[model samples]
Target: MALNPNVPANQEQRTDEIDLFELFSGLWAQKWLIVGCSALALLVATAYAFLATPYYEVHSILRTTQLKELDELNGTGVYKIDPEEALRRVGASLDSYETRVSFFNANRELFEPLKKGSGSLENAFAAFNEEQFTLLQPDPRKTSLVPFVGLKLEYPADVDGVAILNGMVRQAISDEKVRIAQDLEGVIKSRLNVINRQLTAARAKYEASKENKIAGLKEGDEIKRAQLQDELKALRGELRLRRQSRITQLDEAIAIARSLGIVKPTTPTSMGQDAGAAQGNIIRTEVFNQQFPLYFMGSEALEAERNGLLKRRSDDHTEPRIAKIQHELQLLENNRQIQFMQSREDEDLFLAALADLREESSRLENIKLDLSQLQLARVDRPAIEPIKPIKPIKMTIMALGVVLGGMLGVFAALLRVILRRKANALA
Candidate 1:
């Protein structure tokens, strides 16, 4: 009846090996479960994929080029609402500032164009420069992600998902919003026209309105223009004196000093603004190619080298005057570079100012044109079409439900097995 300790130890190791084998064998032992689970997983997946609701999403992308509108964002942080502006005007002018002022005053017919209501949007909503774009929808069910959620909704298998998505898009371009936008545009055009007429009449009556004001503005502008030009000319002269024919000598010094590895530098630049409105933003980039390594040589040497190169001096290496000219030349080139940078900075400032003034001028001219057009025009709304039923997509939902059910079934089985093993251990 006495068991050897060595025999007990070997028996324990064998039991562990057998347990491993048994665990390995269970996958086959549980073959029925594997089949049942697989079938259940498949069934669940089918129900979800087929019976589930399909969802379609839609989106519109637009960029605002509202150039001067930057002032709204930066200055006041107010978003522009075209419809809102129209309504405000309509309300203000309504009933002659009194809701009960007069029947004639309350008459919206005369002011139909100015009406801020959704009705007005029909005629005058402005369309900016845009390329007409179209997109095609693909069968997402084939590789549907997040299908389970759609499946859970039990979305009608025959439910038209595309129709639903299209409806949302149509909602975005809401008829009322579009109508109101058009109306607002009309009102602006009308008001802007009135202003223009008043301005024109005033100009005609005053005869000296534009000329007088512009003359004064121009006088001030002229003084500033002259000052800039004078400074620019002076800077150019300074630059020329600094470099001129003296550059050849300095270049040799830079070549000799290049081995010292001082530095090569780059600076960022914006293109000049002469390209015009039709070009939008096309610009030519210019980069100055000047390489100055160091000022090891003097101006006197540079002058001698220049003279030698020009054949004005004999070819002699022992010329003591060369060093003196080289040093002077180096000083001159430094002065020239400084002047050149100063000129560049000045030009950039002037150019930026000119661009702003020009842009403002363009806007003013547009306003004038709009006012004139308003005086001569009327806008009409297009006919609206009624909504129709959307098409159904059943396959989308079934695929989704299947994948979700399979995952859920797997987790549930895992949990059940863990619990059963724990219970057995306790028993």
Candidate 2:
């Protein structure tokens, strides 16, 4: 007989192929085994459900409030807290070993029952677990704004978990407030120091310029001229001093605004119309100072001409020449006083800058007051005692046990069939 070309060279490969119906029938034949295993698992699950200690979860909702006032005085907008970042920080803090120990100590009454003999306090402290605390940001999807955060604590039902969780939240908020205040104060002080240094330099420059100008003038018999020069110098010095003072005040105001979490407005170079006029006056004074020597020389030439007329014994010429010389001298004196007028113009500029600084400072002070009064975190919902136990859900445990038992039974029945077949093939 000729061997069929379609016949397999290895019959073992065909034997390895599994039939679903046959496997199901094999399992079905051991129905009592499956039922007995399932019943044993159910009994164990029921025993565990009754014996395990129940846990109660207590949770609270906290809403972060405005640490700084709304509508900043400097028009920079209000400061906002990042809820997600804050939650992460608070979570880490609560999970710390030190924090957990502190929490347990603070609520000693709650954990007293957990204490065992002579080392009761030590045992109680050891019972504190970082895992018991949880911090969650409820609306993570709302990234545009920080959402309210939730804090939860889980402990045995016998413990006062609600009180412990509430206390922890309050302490965390207090620490946050202190941290923010210290940071703001440090930044403001650093900026204030820089402004102070600039102000000192400006004042020194103004003083040095005033002294140099006064010392440069030559002494002469022109008493009126001397007096006018002194007055003009004094006026210029006063104007410069005022300007420096106003700048210093403006810096202080800006610092205050920054401390309140407000964007500090740019320090203005000019205070509107008055500042423009002051700048113009400064330029005009510089030009006049340059031309002062020419005016003085002209007055001296007129005086010499009048003396020559007197020596020639021409009364008519002498009288007219004297009058002309007097007129020229008066005009020269007026021109010299132009510097004093310029200084007066600059006074208005300094005054305007000072006014602006004062207004800004006042607004910042008001904001600071408001912030001091505001609370950092408000309790939206205080934690309460949980109504039901959270752990060892009976129904879920029993269902899992039943499924596992059925799977184990089917596996065992299949293994028995495979071992018998292997033995027969060996024989």
Candidate 3:
């Protein structure tokens, strides 16, 4: 009992060191017990792995081909629905509970096999929500200009998950097509309405101008008469210029035709003195007939004449025929001027407005064609049967079990050693 303070402190330090070493040695002595506990945990893990049902996943790819860029109609740009955005909304809609419920309801038989343990359709739907569904675009983080998306479905290994996914994809595509058509139709109809209104306004303006009668000379309005005279003079000048241009075009066209051996004179040898005169007359007639066939005859008659003319051959009499053709062309120009002079300013406006309305009508027809032909989205790749189950990775589960079981066993052994030490101390 007469121990020094330094000796007691040293003894306590030594005891602490021994206790630390004894902990490891104690665990070593009960290594077999630890191994047995680990073996039991491994067996439990194995049983759970075998008992759990495996699930397989199948996926399909979709492509959005809707008109994303602004569409050009009648030289004006119009907005169109973005295909990528529409596809994104469709994907989001698929993820919604309501859409999923609808899908389940529509194809209850497909989901029925998934309801092995479920009590009713609702419970089956609940089970599906818990374990079977995922709809998403692939690689959303990556910036891609292409509108590619993916839909995935998981089910029990025995179920036809691929068929279910395919059905869903088909339904989605049908719905999107209908939506795109309706939207495009609405846009086209709205634009048509606007164009019609504009046309109406233009017609009204033209009618009002006619009622004002400012385009023509009135009986007592001297200033208006002078203005009409000036307009008439300008019209005459333009008509004369157009006539001259037409004459030139006709001359060149006749020369080209003569060069091509399409125009000819029928010379008769029986009438020796009249032969040259007959040839000249025939050439003039042929030139006039070819250039202004529709002027004298109906379109059908003109076509018939053209067919007959095509059968005839001609010799090159370019130098002598030019003067005669020029004379005939002058007569045609004189007739065109008479018709042009008869047209009033109001009549010209009306004709211009009519042309515009016809153009608009043609544009509307094209829009209708586009609506009918448009395809918004399509199934790029269909889902197929999965070769392997995605779930219940046995190796991973076994490895996890081994590591966790070993740690728990070690903790149990340490606890046993500590309890024995306490019992011994109490004794």
Best by TM-score: 3
Comparison by TM-score, 1 against 3, better one: 3
Worst 10 residues of 2 by lDDT: 285-294
- In angstroms, how far off is 403's CA in candidate 3? 2.5
Please identify model 1 stretches exceeding 4 Å from their true place: 1-7, 17-22, 46-427
The sequence of per-residue lDDT tens digits that candidate 3 reaches over residues 174-201 is 5555666676567767877887887788
Q: Which residues of candidate 3, in runs, are more than 4 Å off?
A: 1-21, 63-102, 113-147, 214-351, 362-380
Question: Please, what is the TM-score per model?
Answer: 0.24, 0.47, 0.54
Tens-digit lDDT string for candidate 2 (29-111) = 87878888888788888788878888888888766545343223224222344444445455555445655566666777767
Q: Which should have the higher TM-score, number 2 or number 3?
A: 3
Q: Please give the ranking of all candidate structures by TM-score, highest first, separated by commas.
A: 3, 2, 1
Which window of ten consecutive residues has the lowest lDDT sum in model 1? 146-155
**Model 3's TM-score against the true structure:** 0.54
